[model samples]
Target chain A: MSLDYLTALIAAVLFAAAPLILAALGETISERAGVINLSLDGTVLFAAMVAFAAARATDNPWLGLAAGGLAGAGIAAVLGVFGLLLGASELAVGFVLTLFCRELAYFMGHGQARQPGPDLGALNLPFLSDLPLFGPAIFRQSPVVLLSLVAVGLVWFFLMRTRAGLVVRAVGEAPAAAVARGLAVTRTQFLCCLAGGALGGLAGGLYSLSVKPGWGHPQGCEGAGWIALAIVIFGGWKPVRVALGALFFAAIQVAGIALQDVLPGLSGTLFQIAPFPVMILTLLVVNLRRSAAFREAARRVPLLGRLVPRTAGGAPGAIVGALDKGF
Target chain B: MTGRTSSLARAGFSLALALCVTLAIVAAAGAPPLTTLAVMLDGGLGSGQAVLRTLSALVPLLLCGAALCVTFAANLWNIGVEGQITLGAVCCVWFLRDLGLAGLVPPFLAVPGALAASMVGGAAWALLSGVLRTHGRVHEIFSGLGLNFVAMGVSLWLILGPWKRPGMASMSGTEPLPAALWLPALGGRPMSLWGLILAVAAFVLVAWVLNRTFFGLTLSAVRQNAMAAERLGLRPKRRMLAAMALGGALAGLAGGVLVAGLYHRLIPSISGNYGYTAIMAVLLASGSLRFLPLACLFFAVLTVGSIQLPLALSLDSSLAGVVQGVLVLTLFAARRLWPAGNTGSTGGTRNRGSAA
Candidate 1:
């Protein structure tokens, strides 16, 4: 394809990847703080439905976005209460909430399905829009894409450069130690989960108001949440890598669409279904480096041995520690 | 608060809380709460036909719940049960179509053969995730969720591509199987008695295996501490794999029943969220096999009754889902509030002794 076509494809990838990046980043935060929110898939769907309906009703996308974020925070609060305070299994609670929210969204948003709603249109930056290859691809996008970009940097900075970030990391790494150090583990985790939920909510709003631009039962965003969860793992619970994982997933989706013409039989169905398996495979590979058998097998092949890392580690200490706790 | 009395009290409180929450939602939706409840009850069990419909729905729920309980007992999250069910149905259909065995073999043989194929298909699908967990180090939840999507894609491809009906491919699904391949209906009802019978048998077998056998003790031991179980000569991985396979087989059998008994054909939505709903049923049972049938029946009533919401109150059928969700959440809340006599073990707690 021509450079212009390629740029447009890249732009499409960015637009699509924005939601995943946002949701995954949110999950990264929650999980980093030792709270797992499996309700993301349902939360996104519910937020999407709510945002779309609110926007259509009020004729204001901003209000709709706020509503979506609030809904997300609300759901996260429930998770926090049960998981952090009550000491329930966050995974189980989140899973049930996911199903519940999904069903509720369908039930409540039935009337709003296929209805017209405001969409955030493209906002091209003057100087940047005129730049060579990156102009149209990066600068001439909706505010949501820009927001997602800002979020990546902000999240990275917040986690790496701030005292609060240190505490969050410490809490996730070792809740008992954090507690001993006078940090309120439960309160910090609860707040982190809520913040993550808000981001996830915003992601849902972006999905409806920008990316897909409509509400439909079993909307196009169904499995996107699970992919976000996997992306968080794929990114190794880091912000920058998480963003990359989201972009990579989006690229796969765009490439799948692009390949529809060249590979007629396999492109549509197979391509659409490709991300899940590919994510699972990526997870397996990322994790396999830690396995002794894999290391032994790698040792037999000189090239593989050279390529393999000496150690596969970097899971948050608290997460690894909590694994023994059965969560 | 001790023993059975406290447990009963907790359950009662959770049910009441769930009811209040659901009623509040109904009110918010502009429907009269009492009227809606009455309508749902009538729709689910007012007549013989309604009860039959509820019972038919119960067959799959019970089977899936029983299946889930096995995996849960072993501390394995078989979230891919939905996908397994779909694959099972797909395999059953494939066996009937490609092998031409439906016509070649006797009715009795063909029916059992198709079901066996379904079980194999489901088990194999689940085993993929099991291997991933044991060897690949990937969590079962993520792998299972991913596999669920892949299974859906496969079913869609079969329906819209290879197995597309004559003329035009549609979402209506493939043509019905031959009469000889179909399971016989119960007492002139649309559903098959065989499905119900099979589900009950499976439940009884699982309950016995889980509660009364040495295998049950070992399985629990493995769940409680895989490392310790390994030290004690039990292969944790093998037990886990067996548990997953058995769960898959049960769920697959549910799917087989759906095809051979109810739908009479393999459709994309054949699984119909039964696998997911079973999770709620199993959770509601809270480690007690005796409550499994009751939980399944309760959910079946809500599901079958939800059909009336659209017809009577102009509400979506998904209202049932809202109720189910509220119920589970409240149940969890109640368990937390009254931990004294709660016998229902959250999956995380039974194995690792974590606070969760």
Candidate 2:
């Protein structure tokens, strides 16, 4: 491919990755706080529709983004109240809400289907746009794309550097210990879930107002939430890694489209279906490090024996640790 | 509050809450809430035809619900029932074409053969997820979700590719199966009497297996404590796989019924969210086999009735899904608030199984 063609592909990948990054990061935060918000797919769909409708009505993209974020937080609040406050099963509530929100979106958004709405366009930075390959690929993008990048850095710094970040990790890792240390476990979790939800809503806005643009029946965002959930696991709940996971997923999607010309017989349907299996495989590999049998098998291999670590690491302690309880 | 009384009160309150919320939504949409609901009821059950349509919808819901009961009792979330149904339909269509039995074989023989193919297809698809859970340490929920996507892709490929119509492929679907292969309809009703009979038989079989068999006891034991079950000489993994296979087979039968009896064509939307809606029905049943039929009918009404919403209120029929979703959420909340004395821990364990 020509340099220009490659750069354009890279840029397209970035734009596509934006929503995934936002949603996955939000999930990372929520899961790290010892809560799994499985309603992400529905939340994103509802938010996208709401965002599009809001933008169409107000003629303001920023308002649409805010509306999307609020919608997400509102849905997440349902999880917070029921799962966290009422001590209901988070998974069951989330699963129900996911289906509910999806249907609700379809019902309310029927009128908005296929209607044109305000969308974010590329904004070239004065200095950065002048740079060669990186400029066009990274700098010459919509504000949402830039914000998504900044979000990666911000989430990382918040989780790794801030005191509140410590509290978040502490609650996720050892809620009882955090409780004993005087941290209000429930409050922290509730706040984290809300924050995570807001991000998810913004991700939805990114989809309707920028990435995919326009709403239609079935909306085409059905699997994005589940992919984001898988990405959180694939990234080991780390912000930077989660961002990379999003980029990697987006790259696969872009590459699939790009390869259609080179390999006509491969079929677009095959390409479309590729990510789910790939994500499932990645999930297995990530979890394998913790499985004793996998570790034993790795030790028997000549090269892998030397490289494989004796101890598994990186999973958010509370989220995966709860698995041991079989709950 | 006494447990039973509290539970009753909570149920009443939640129902009211759901009604209010739904009405508020209807009003916001500029539709008369009471009239809209009346139309929905009329559409779902007003005439004999409407009742028949609802009964037809109940076939898949009941089958899928019964299927889920098998796996859920064993504490496996076979979320891929949606995908399994698709595969079943695909298999049914393929059987009809490849067997070349449209005219050669008798209707009874061809139909049974096609149904068997669907069961095998669904079982095989579900077994893949079961294997992943047992061996690969992957959660069935995620694996099932992934497999669902793969199943959709496969069906799409079949419709748009090799199975495409003679002239050109379209989203409409593959050509209809020959008339001889179609299931016999019931007295000019939209649904087949055979499909209803099959669903009833499946439900009875599931109830019997769960309540009367040693296998059912083993499944419960495994669900409660795999380690304990292992020590007691019961193979938890094997039981799990069996439960999943049984579940998949039933769901596949639902798919087969949809194709042979209802749609008679393998369209992409054939499943119609039946697999997912069945999850809600199963959950609402709360492990009671007797309640399964009622739960299925209730949801069937919501879905079948919602079809009138777009016509009467200018609303999307998907509002039915919204109601179902809210109902499940409300049930979860009520379960927490009331704490049913005997079933409390079962609810707790189910939560943990999915959460982890």
Candidate 3:
């Protein structure tokens, strides 16, 4: 690939990475707290429609964002009540939430399907946007990109340093212990589950307002939520690493789209299934070695040094808390 | 939950609970409480045909659902029942493509061919995940989920590309099968006798397989505690794979019956979320063999009722999907309200509805 292609690829990757980064980061926190919100995709779809409708109805981008957050939180709250308080299986509960939210969203967004909204405009930096290959491509991207990066940093810092983060992790590590130690397991689970759903929803909103920028059709939201969940697994539950996981996926998707222009034969009907194949492939690859082999493989990568945790010197523990205890 | 509560009372309580929750939601929507109940009941059960059609709808659902219970009992999550059914129908269409073949062979051959292909499709699709979980040490849920997307893509590709009916422009779908390939209506007897008998047989077989045989006992043990069972020299992976394969076959059979018995041709929407619909039934029937059919019929009624709610009230018909979701979630919650046996953790509940 030439420099121009590389530039285009990088730019596309950054843009594509935004939604996944936001979503995966959200999932990491939720899963870390021992709650797997399987409703991510539905949350995204519902929020996207609501956000688009609000933008169209009120003509304010901020209101649309708020509407998206509210709709997402509302669905999340329902999940929270059922899974946390009522003690339903989180995965099953989230799955049901997705169906419910998607249907409700379709109903709420019925007439708005053909309509458009006030799109989220791009944020063009000053002199930075004028530079050669990198200038216009990276510097002139949407604000969602920068916001997601900042969000990742914030999440990482909180998870690593904050007492609240420790509590959340503790809940996942041992809910019974947490409860025994005076922590309100129910309340923590409830809040964390809803918050996860809400964030996933907000990310869905960003997709609509910034990426697609209008009412979506059926299957409108697509599998971004699943991708986010995949990224969380791929990243092994770290904010910075998860962001990179998002970026890795973003790069592949951009390449897949761009390859359509370069080599038409490569972009056949089968390429539509690329994400599934790639996801399955990555999952297999990630699980290939025992913990020791994974550590050895990570040790050789220089730039990825920071991405691998010190614990990576030992066995890697991924897919943590995917299931609830005593289920 | 208590044995003190009569079986009749427990059943009544659940139905009433469902109705009360549903009516409360309707009331919140500003509809008159009694009027909504009447609407739901009329739409669901007022007419004889309506009730029969609902039962008919439950036919395929029960087929795939009973099949799901078999696999779920062994802790396998088979998410490709929809595609398997499509494959079965596609196989029948392919078999009867040359109209002369339909005239040449009896419907018996056609029926087995359709059902066999679906079982193969379901088994192969599930086997991929089962292998990954067993050998690759990957989790079944993610692999199964990934398979769902792959199946959809393959289905879309087949219908839209190679299998595209000639000269059809609007959308891609299989042409209708030749009539000889259709499952006969039981010596010209009506009332879906063939389908009804098959469904009943499926229910009985699943109950027997999960309860009667040594294999069934072993599989249940595997589901409850793989590690402990493994120490007893029972191969968990093998059992799990067998369970998934069995699940796929059952789901595929449902798909087969649907095509040969009802639709007579496979359209792209063959499964139409019915696999997930089975999930709802499975969730409602959690841990109970006898209650499975009851839950299935109740699910059918709720589904049919929701479809009619819009005509009965000014509510949108899509309320059916929401109600279905709520039913699963509510039943799951109710299950948790009083946790029962510590049978096992890996007792994978069929989201037959993913339906969960």
Model 3 spans with C-alpha error above 4 angstroms: A1-7, A131-135, A174-188, A216-219, A261-270, A290-327, B4-49, B95-107, B168-172, B185-192, B304-317, B338-356
What's model 1's overall lDDT?
0.85
The regions of model 2 sitting more than 4 angstroms off are A265-267, A306-311, A321-327, B1-6, B100-107, B340-345, B349-356
A1-89, model 3: which lDDT tens digit per residue? 78777777677778778878877877788777766778888888888888888888899877887788777777878877766666566
- Per-residue lDDT of A1-327 in model 2, one digit per residue for the tens? 788888898788888899999999999999888888989989999999999999999999889999999999999999999888787767777878888888988888989998878898778889987688668888888777788999999999999899999999988877777788899988999999999998999999999999889898878777899999999988878899999999999999888988998999866988888889998898887777667776688778877665454445566655663332221
DockQ of each: 0.54, 0.54, 0.38
lDDT of 1 at B206: 96
Clashing pairs in model 3, backbone N/Cα/C closer than 3 A: B276-B353, B279-B351, B279-B352, B279-B353, B351-B354, B351-B355
Q: Residues B52-73, candidate 2, lDDT per residue (tens digit)?
A: 9999999999999999989987
The per-candidate count of clashes, in order, stands at 0, 1, 6
Docking class of 3: acceptable
**Candidate 2 or 3, higher TM-score?**
2
Provide the interface RMSD of candidate 1 in angstroms, 1 decimal place: 3.7
Ranked by TM-score from best down, the candidates are: 1, 2, 3
Q: Give the C-alpha miss distance for residue A299 in model 1, angstroms.
A: 5.6
Candidate 1, superposed: residue stretches over 4 Å from native? A295-301, A305-313, A321-327, B100-102, B344-356
TM-score of chain A of 3: 0.85
> How does candidate 3 fare on TM-score?
0.85
